[model samples]
Target: MNQNRVQASEVAPRAGLADISILANASLTSVTGTDMTSNAQGNYDLALKYSGTGLASVGVADKKVLVYALPAELQGKVVGGATVDIDANLLPITPGDIPGVKVLFDALGVTINTLNAVLPIPSVVAAFNQLKTVQNLGAYQKTLPAVVSADGKTISVEFTQELSEYVHQAYVATFGSLRAAIDALQGGNVVTKPLIDGLKLAADKLFDVIELIASGGSDILDLALNGNILGDMNGTLHTTVSDPGAASATVKAGAINNALISADVLTAIEQEGEAVTLNFPTTAVNPIENYDVAAPVITQPVAGQTQVAGQVTLTQPIPDRTTFEAVVTLPDGSTKNVPLAADGTFVVDTGSLVDGQTISAKVVATNGTYTKDSPITTATVTAAPIENPIADYNVATPSVAPLTAGDPEITGQVTLNQPIPLGTTFEAVATLPDGSQLTGTVESDGTFKSAGVDQLAAGQTVTNG
Candidate 1:
């Protein structure tokens, strides 16, 4: 042994294919050898011969083996299974095989036509095509983890920071105008020109626009924008009275004097003290006729009078004697009580008024328990005219002849100291004993005869006519 012993290193280094061990009693018949090649597709074939009839297993039985053409750093690391070649089958790497690599690729592959089938929206398809051209798309894809279902029908994508950032940017770009509009609305910085023009248009066709919106649906916008705002302008719409400081009944009368409302419409509302109630009519028509607040008609104090006669008369009777009083104001500014008669005649004797002095009078009516006053009517007064009397006139007594049975006529003669004027006409009036009156006309000579005396009785007496 010491003479020719071979070292194990030397023998091991020189060992060839023939020196390789095989199962016991199993022998190699022949091997088709090929030249060693550096190409990945290089192959070698071996033939085996066995003398024994028993079967022999090749490689490890009932064991899964994985072979990966990995880099030098990951040579021993557990990777994809050799049972199914990942590259040959085009299967994606899973997190189970590689702790960090989560990939799911469809066997059919994803294409633009496939995405177009899923998303029919043209804008979405265009956006997807644009996304594929982005320079950072690969970086984003690397951060996204996908999972394939066991059934191989679905691919679920897990949320990732890169995906989140991409989604946020997409949302902002898509809704940029909407976000700006909302901000403008919140800040009350809307464009005034367009708003005003739109408002004017709506005002012009308010009913039509309301009808259109109402036909849409029954939501809050329908009710607030159309139903509540566009209905009839009746009831409390045009006229609503509220008293914040006091009770509703304590509001002052005439405080709501809208010119559109007539006095008759408000007459029933008490204008006086507390507890005054307003009773509006169901209809808007004014019920009272000739409703007015005109001055009272004064009928006395005749025009163009030389004397100051303190008398006043109204065409119509006073409404209430208890609440009204007539007064005559003298030129000296003194007032006299002018008692009103039931017939509306009033007399105020400012005894012996001075010549050419003017007199004025007014009737004042008061509201019961309320200090309010009706319109006062002032009477027009004028001075009474001066007069002259005739100095002398003759009076003649006429004698009458008694009526006889045969002579039914009663004759009488009247004498004046002066001759009557040529154009003057005379008349005589007589009173009979029966309290009846008889009339006769005198001739130019002043003598007159009564012919209707035929009805005179015996006890009846006749006087000068």
Candidate 2:
């Protein structure tokens, strides 16, 4: 194979990525093939190598490493009896030989074939610029020059592993710019409230993804850089469109238009040094206006409360168009709904809740446009403490004189085994010989007094138990 010959293909349209209107495609060039003599297995191998000389020329920094190949030419050999495999290698440059190119490969295994297939040089350059400008990575930029290999003569052909950090940093910086732009727009109240909220939420999630990548290290970086994140997000969003046929197309078109409009609004804001309005058309078919609404926040009940019932009064009364319901989940796995009053107060049922059991509650708010559910709040059931009854307590016998002849009153002093409780009361009783009984109150000092009794009743006795 000729080392200097680089093949190219006709430009093709980029589907699903209509927003990126950059260099769509490159022109095609003829592949000057070497003698393809088939081996015993009827397979042919093509190998191409690029030296460091051409890359050492003046204005080499501006030269792109990307190349496009037509699929027809690749299929021509496969259509024949022979199988074809093409391999290319880009040798590294010495760091000392180049002035502007500080490190040839940055020890990052970026080959020319990888640049041509996976990533173009223009995107890498653009991402680097964003990292510098948005994240203030001047120190990081300085460290880029020190990542070269010891000899800088050979590089691994895989680009994803090498450019993972580069792409992740670029994603972070780009997300930051987008967040800042959205903040500016929201602060100015330029976009509709729902749209602003939706964009902010999406940006926040993207930020979380970036943070996750930072913590997960290289494997996550490779996955995200290979478009898994975007692809997953696209699949998730496609499920939410009401009309899958025509509405999907309209929604995508509206999204592209809105993105373009947002960019223009951001530019205007930067130029005028002030807030600016963003105007984008909204129709029934293009439901960008119906973004997600934030969930309501509910207060928790007092700890150890036996019942989970409470009156939830919202700060602002819910609008007539909106409806609110409190979903109460019992320990038995059954659910109950509590409707909200016009005044935005909901009194949930607590009869089903029992002591030591837990019940979960969440609020669901819905309008015709959007529905949201609050985070679940749980409360453990508890009951008021019961006082222990007077059990296993001893009492001394009452001391009373034998019945005298005169009508003398009954009197006695009784002792208790345990200390008297604050609300404890004592009573004295006398059983007469006629099978009747008389009772009296006892003072805190353990002294008792009864009604007058005849002294003639000699067999009568008085006791305190």
Candidate 3:
């Protein structure tokens, strides 16, 4: 026998060998055949030769070196000859070849028959198809919930754990000491200066945030959440995570219960009853009850007034238990607190004030717990001008005229030693011998005429009255 180089195996004895079989298998499961040989057309042709066998028993037509050829890697394991078929393509085979052919046939889930059957071959192919739709997922969106009362006065917010964590991170980033303190606290360390400072800083930051949210809108909170949309009560989304949107959260403010107090300078008089009255406008939301209102205003002196005094009236009547005060800033800049009467009125003496000096005044109402003040008003001191009354006047002799008609008349002009005012009036009286008197008033041009005077003789005395 020729020395076999590939492997030394038993060659079938001519007495026992009835057919030829060939098997090709790789040691590794994957295809790593670097020495694969193929024809120019990319077809792998493998030839098998056998000799000196019971070839006639195997139904060999001629014993002159029978040869069989098959495709490399295409053929399966060798076994007893049997019928074989691949994708409707058949090969000459016997019952013994069925096992080896069934390996490839059964792997493709195809079937074959060894007796009186035409084989059908199956071809395998692979392909990749394009998808009809695709989707991209990114970070999740977040939102902070808040509620506002109907009156739009008070607003409350509940922070989520995620939001709280974010706030903590923000605090730590803003204050370096905060991070250390937090770490120490997490590590169960004792309180220290840094921890106290951190706590103060955190409180301040929290208060600032609260104030901002309370005073302004929640645009800041929305920004912190990195969400474009705010959630509404109706579950409507207002913003998007990546782009700006017109979504806003609803925050209804409740009616404010506290009193809305305000005051103004109503009347600032510098006359004999010099007084200032502060008026508070009417409020509907929060009534002016259970509260005191005060205002301080500067009152300037009137043209001829010398004293300053004031009063205040609230929209609501002052409670009986409330105490009122008027804080007066004197012309010398000294201040005095004077009690106010139940009528919300007060008076201040201006004797110490000089002419043209300004005084500041303010009124305050207090109920022990709550107090309100009016705006400041100024008052200036002034004195009335001096004047002397007229003492005497001159009366000219009366001219007697007989009335052409029914009654006798007396006519005369009254003159003053000192010029009296143009509008001043003087009276003239004429006494008759009968003890009756005739009187008349002076006219604008300084003439007086008495009507219905007693008839007198030419010499009868008609005295000027």
Model 3 regions lying over 4 Å from their true place: 1-306, 317-320, 382-465
lDDT tens per residue, model 3, 1-465: 456832455653332111221111101110222222322222222211111112111111111111111111112312112211101001112211123222332322211111102221111111000001121111112432333223322222222333333333332233233223323332213534444344445435444443443343333432332321111111111110110111211111111111121111000000111111211112221212435465643444554454576777653544433566898877677788889776667777655555677778887766445566777877566665555444344444545444333347777664554566455567778776577887888776667887776556655665666
Q: Write the per-residue lDDT of candidate 1 for residues 7-110, one digit (tens) a residue.
A: 54345343221222111232212122111111111111111111111112211111111111111221222111111111100011111111111011111113
Q: Using TM-score, give the best candidate's number.
A: 2
lDDT of each: 0.32, 0.37, 0.36
Clashing pairs in 1: 305-383, 305-384, 306-383, 306-384, 306-385, 307-383, 307-384
lDDT of 3: 0.36
Residues 1-465, model 2: lDDT tens digits = 344343323433333322321112211111223323323222333322211111111111121121111111232222122111112122222221222121322212233223324323343334323433423211111111111112321111212222334444543444454345434533323434444455455445544555665554434434222221110000001000011121111011111112222334323322321111211223323221232323333445444443455444553433334567778887777888988666555565555445677777777766556566766777665555675656534556777655565556777777755765556678888765555667888787878777855554555544433
Worst 10 residues of 3 by lDDT: 123-132
RMSD of candidates 1 onward, in order: 45.0, 27.2, 44.4
The full ranking of all candidates by TM-score, starting with the best, is 2, 3, 1
- How good is model 1 by TM-score? 0.20
Error of 3 at 354 (Å): 2.9
lDDT of 2 at 423: 65
Report how far off residue 260 is in candidate 3 (Å).
47
